[model samples]
Target: MEFEVVVEGAAGALVAERAGAARVELVAALVDGGLTPSLGTVAAVLGALSATRVFPIVRPRGGDFVYDRYEAAAMEHDVRAFAAAGVHGVVVGALTPEGAVDRPLVRRLVAAAGGLPVTFHRAFDVAADPRAALEDLAGLGVARVLTSGQEAAAIDGAPLIADLVRRSAGRVAVMAGGGVRAEDAADLVAATGVEELHFSGMAAVPGPAVHRNPRVRMGGTAVPPEDERRVNDPVRIAAIMAAGRAGAARRARP
Candidate 1:
């Protein structure tokens, strides 16, 4: 099984590469559930990475997957920028008010990706029908779909993920993500039969602040000041990768 680690910047990308991750999903403001990263950050990550693929998320904002004309246009511009930066792919998805894949708008974004492969992000999890959305993504020639089967965690949604894998029939890759951990990697993959897994092996690291401000907050929500800085822990990432590979090997045994 391949591991796709979610990273925020160049430092995280380097950590992922060193930790044996196969790919990195570059994003910004992960606390907001990941938004489109800046072009400079993308360029830095691309330059720092050696073999690991970079698939930057093209979301203009967090909250909902529903996008308007302006957001769609911005996403297109970002996609083009990523392609020009020599990224491996882009992670993108759009939904309608009824929670269905916005095929027409997604088609336009995919077209903007040029020849790069696209991975429909977890927006599929909120769709009205998983099977229907899988079909639509396949029809769009998406290389993969990152989902947790509409649940808070992939293990909790393993049954639906398994069904999605069976229904996909190799037409599109079903990547199980959301709260993936080293301990549960085997069970999730064994149950879902997924070839890829996505996770953010992140942990809270202390920031370099001599004096702390108790009344200031950079985020919209209230979070502990010390918990604001999260970084990719290579040890955690390596453990997850090792556990996932071991599980895959175990399943392959006769």
Candidate 2:
């Protein structure tokens, strides 16, 4: 049973380390649901937190889990690059046209991970059938699967998560993620018996004001070109980690 924080940058890693997290998933542009982090970012986090295992997301972009041929190629390259750079694991996933787990393609990606642990990311939630997908992922030797219990939130999906936990039966790790806050992680663990919890621990940060082109507004009104949203914040990360640790400890005690 361990807690891993998803870190978008060096600042995030620092927070995770200080909070005593077991590991950190290094990614970039969490604004887009996390893209592959730069090599320097990976290197820096690894150097700064030598003991904490770092797993970098392998997606070249953030959007849908289904990737085209070119995107798939990029994913392979990203996995190799991360492995060469000494990352502990690569987090990735892909699906087929029918919304089923793309078993063959995903297996290839897993193989490319080159002995490093591979985690099937939340793309598992989109699988047409979660039970079948879990079996498929286990067969592919995926070290873990990051899922939201195929629901909007882990708590809401706790039943399915518990079912999957029973189904998996230690064949592979089932990590409960998505919409998980420090407050709810313990409940999720208790209800589903999941040992790994994941979340961004995000907070709002100021970005550039997005404004539409006023000079070209001959037929349009003023509108912001760019809109802002909440993103991962270091301050909140520690609190989230504390909550996870406290929760896991309580569960372990009795």
Residue 202, model 1: Cα distance from true site in angstroms: 0.6
Each candidate structure's count of clashing pairs = 0, 4
* Reference-based lDDT, residue 16, model 2: 75
> How high is the CA lDDT of each candidate model?
0.90, 0.81
Cα deviation of 32, candidate 1, in Å: 1.1
Native-to-model Cα distance after best TM-score fit, residue 13 in candidate 1, in Å = 0.6
Model 1 residue runs over 4 Å out of place are 224-228
List the candidates' TM-scores in order: 0.96, 0.86
lDDT of 2 by residue, 17-86 (tens): 7766777888886656678899899988888885778999988776688888899888888898889988
RMSD of 2: 4.1
Clash pairs of candidate 1? none
Q: Candidate 2 at 167: error in angstroms?
A: 0.8
Q: What is residue 115's positional error in candidate 1, in angstroms? A: 1.3
Instruction: Name the runs in model 2 displaced over 4 angstroms.
Output: 206-235, 249-254
Q: Residue 136 CA error for candidate 2 (Å)?
A: 0.4
